[model samples]
Target: MWARRTWTDGDHGYLAELYDRITAPTITTHEPILRKAPDLSDAWWDSLSTALDAIAAVANNRVAVRQEYLDRAMPHYLGIPIDTTVPAWTAAHGDLHWANLTAPVLTVLDWEGWGSAPAGYDAALLHSCSLLVPDTAAQIRHRFAHILGTPAGRFAELVVITELLQTTTRGDNLELEAPLRARLRFLTER
Candidate 1:
């Protein structure tokens, strides 16, 4: 980012940011959806993991995923009694999906909602978005197993699934409803 300018217009506020140009195309053209998996190299995965780790290490006061939202959405979406307690929290990209990620060199875009969330929330969100591509979903699971296999990561996945399921009710992400529910069952049952 080069510069940031903020202004208030009566009751609202606006902010404009300047950033260096990204030449690489995003992994997916659609927002929050991944129809196909790109053949990414190990280096790309490593870079992404490192970037996420760096983001998680940052200190921020903003809340992207709230406790109140989790408390209400967990059991309702999972259809079972769930412990919504997140074991760990960290800074996150908040909206980490294929469309927000560039290929060849791994550039994460869209920081409008970046803030604190459950640990591994970014990976969970990315996995959820990749459900349409089973291979990609499995790759995410394998790559981030340390995070996605833990209690905190499982809860974070549940949180993301809940959010996606909620979106389905509004006629969005209709294609993801079945897989999202299946993943919910897997998470809740285990």
Candidate 2:
């Protein structure tokens, strides 16, 4: 970010940060959701995974996704008393979707929600957003299998699914409702 500013008017206050322009285009279309697999190189994939790993290593107190939210949301959305306790916690991008990523060269955009979350929360979020594109979703799962295959990983995925499903009630990501439910059922049955 090049500049940041804050201003207040009466009881209202606003904050903004200006960033340098990025030349690389986002991996997917304008929407944050991925509808198809992008034709990015293996190196790009490696870079993305590495970047996520690095981000997770950072220490922070900010809470992007809360345990209370997870505990409340899981049973409501999955109709099961699923455990919401994360095996591990780490920093995450919080909104790691296709549109927030750039191809050719990896560049992560949007840090507004960066904070601590479940260990594999970022990977789970990226995978969840890629569900409409099976190939991409599979690639995400494969790339992050080390994280996504563990109990912590599964719980992270559950958290992502629950959040998405809850948003559907407000008419957001409505197209993902069925897929999210399907994933939810599969996870619960495991």
Q: lDDT tens digits, residues 1-190, model 1?
A: 5888999999999997879778999998867799977989999999999999999999999989999998998888776787888889999999999999998988999898999999999999999999999999999999999999998899899999999999988999999999999998888778
After superposition, the stretches of candidate 2 with alpha carbons farther than 4 Å from their true spots are: 6-12
lDDT of 2 by residue, 65-152 (tens): 9989878888898778867788899999999988899878999998899999999999999999988998988988898999999998
Least well predicted 10-residue stretch by lDDT in candidate 2 = 28-37
Compared with the true structure, the alpha-carbon lDDT of candidate 2 equals 0.89
| Cα lDDT listed for each candidate | 0.92, 0.89
Native-to-model Cα distance after best TM-score fit, residue 173 in candidate 2, in Å: 0.9
> Given candidate 1, what's the lDDT at residue 1?
50
